[model samples]
Target: MVRLDRITTRGGDAGETSLGEGSRVRKDTARIEAIGAVDEANAALGLLRAQIAAAGADAEADAMLARIQNDLFDLGADLCVPGAEATDARTGRTRLRVSDAQSARLEAEIAAMNAALPPLASFVLPGGSLAAAQAHVARAVVRRAERRAVRLAAEETVNPAVIRYLNRLSDHLFVLARRLNRNGAGEALWVPGGARQG
Candidate 1:
């Protein structure tokens, strides 16, 4: 439904960008920062998906990542329009916002993926198969995005569901990484104080 005829609008050349409501704000504003973080997380997901496809990993995980990417777009849209609930005055149409159901779906996926994985005896080291490593990277980015969203929420009204979704997403990515690591077969567990030279 969105059309982009011109890629270079030269709109942000002045260090200000337009929000969904047509108001311009500095690029460094908290709202913009949150949106940028979400965008970065989405890009990370894309990279993870590429690694998954390259390794011929689980198709189900790739499918989940695809859905999460779309959800990130929805989250970005929700942030662009300020307010916990926003509606267009002329058309009386409510703006696109993140719903609790989306977050619930992520929780369900996380639970399902984690059900078969072995219990963790130690903390994960964030390296395993290429796809699993990529998943860890994506998880880190999502955590950063969640922090940015929380920062924005402190300064202004934000939909609680947006923050909830980001929180659950990071957890989902963590569990997915473990799942991609051959259900703990390829995972590297931390060895406390093992690196110390006696």
Candidate 2:
């Protein structure tokens, strides 16, 4: 149980923030950037959830987004500490790290959702019902988070599962967006040169 009794700690007044293992790094470091991207994705998911609730779109999607929101926090925690095998010195317990099971769960969900959606004849244009559009936004943000994590991986020992989770999450969001769009009924598919004047 993590406690945050003080929200306005002057710890980062020097432009350096503490890592999970008590090491301090600049606020703009790759690790922090990756973590910040994940946080942004989580916020996008929150907005998607609100759209879902307001539109009364799909209860199942709301539930799924809720779970994914929690997972993003786990991802942020994993990135906050350096190294895959990092463990807490005081607790002698492994730090919170993403697992293959998490990505696999996302794969399963994506498969289940895609199974019901009609085959796409054209590329999606990222617009549909409000909830679906919000899902698209969340998907784009998750992709950005994945790119940031990949950048961090190039420089540090990032967990492989972190990348996998983000990758699968974007796909999961894409499929879920379709599901939210009435199983592709409300989806806006792109038409090649449809707007061109002949």
Candidate 3:
């Protein structure tokens, strides 16, 4: 467990922040950007969770979002530190890195959720119940986060599993949105070039 004794240490006032293991880097680094993107996705999940509780439905989806939020935090922890290995001679603490099993679990859940839903004949338009709307927002944010992580990987070594997790996570959110959309009955479908008078 990590404890915060002070919230404002005036540490980043100079536009520099410390990463894991006390390594300082500028706030605008690719790793920091990736972390921020994950944080944004997590915040979107929070909105989805609130909508879930308010509706008093989909308890299972709520639980899943809670777990994914925790996993994103772990991903942030993983990104903060540069080394792939959790423990090294330089930093002798056990760091939390995302596991392949976690990503696989998301894939399994996506498959299960999608099995009962009707096949999509058109693109989804991101509207349904409140919870479903929030899920769509989260899915877009997670996609952005995945792209940021991939960009970071190009410049530096990143855990391959984390990228996989983010990719699968976006899919999970997409299916979850559909599941919350009256079991895919209420999805807003987009018509290709159906608009404007021909």
Candidate 4:
């Protein structure tokens, strides 16, 4: 686990930050952008966790979110180092990287959770219960993170697992939202023309 010795390092006060390998880059780089998006998504998950806990929702979902939050930290560390070969300057250890196993686990859990939900006849409008609403928010954030990761991959040698995990995480959040909505009991379905004036 990485320890924070100081909270106010002012490291990025010059618009540059250090990577996992001790290399410095502009804070606005694609890698940093991707990491920022992932961090935001993780924060959204935290909000969802709090909402679910307050509502006394399912314990499994809470545990899942906690695990995903930890996974997001790993992902942030992975994005800190570019390419497939980078040894940390301080620890002299290979930088962290997302793996296929993480994505695979998300897929499996998504399948299991989705199995209990009803068929969706229309688009979801990001509402049902408070917990579900927050889950939807988290899902949207994860989608943004996935897009940023994809853009980074196009420019550099990104691990396929990173993109894969983001993709699966969004799907998992979607299914989790549905599941938390009491298995689609009263979801706010979208109607394409229902809002138009007749």
Comparing 1 with 3 on lDDT, the higher-scoring candidate is: 1
lDDT by residue (tens digit), candidate 4, 1-198: 668889999888999999876799998999999999999999999999999889886999999889899999989988888786556566788777788889899999999998889889888999889999989999999999999999999999887888999999999998998898888886889988888958
Name the TM-score of candidate 1: 0.97
Q: How many steric clashes does model 4 contain?
A: 0
The residue pairs found clashing in candidate 4 are none
lDDT of 1 at 72: 100
* Per-residue lDDT over 50-89 for candidate 1, one digit per residue giving the tens place of the 0 to 100 score: 9989888699999999999999999999999998776777
Extract clashing residue pairs from model 2: none
- On a 0 to 100 scale, what is the lDDT of residue 81 in model 1? 92
The candidates, ranked best first by lDDT, are 1, 2, 3, 4
Worst 10 residues of 1 by lDDT: 84-93
Better of 1 and 3 by TM-score: 1
TM-score list, all predictions: 0.97, 0.95, 0.96, 0.94
The reply for model 4, stretches above 4 Å from the true place, is 86-92
Q: Per-residue lDDT for 1-198 in model 3, tens only? A: 899999999999998899987889999999999999999999999999999999999898898889999999999999988867867666486778899999988988999899989999889999998889989999999999999999999999898898999999999999999999999988889877778648
Off by over 4 Å in 2: 86-91
* Winning candidate number (lDDT): 1
Q: 1-198 in candidate 2: lDDT tens per residue?
A: 899999999999999999988899999999999999999999999999998899866888888889999999999999998988757667799789999999999999999999999999999999888888988999999999999999999999999999999999999999999999899999999989988957
The CA lDDT of each predicted structure is 0.95, 0.93, 0.92, 0.90
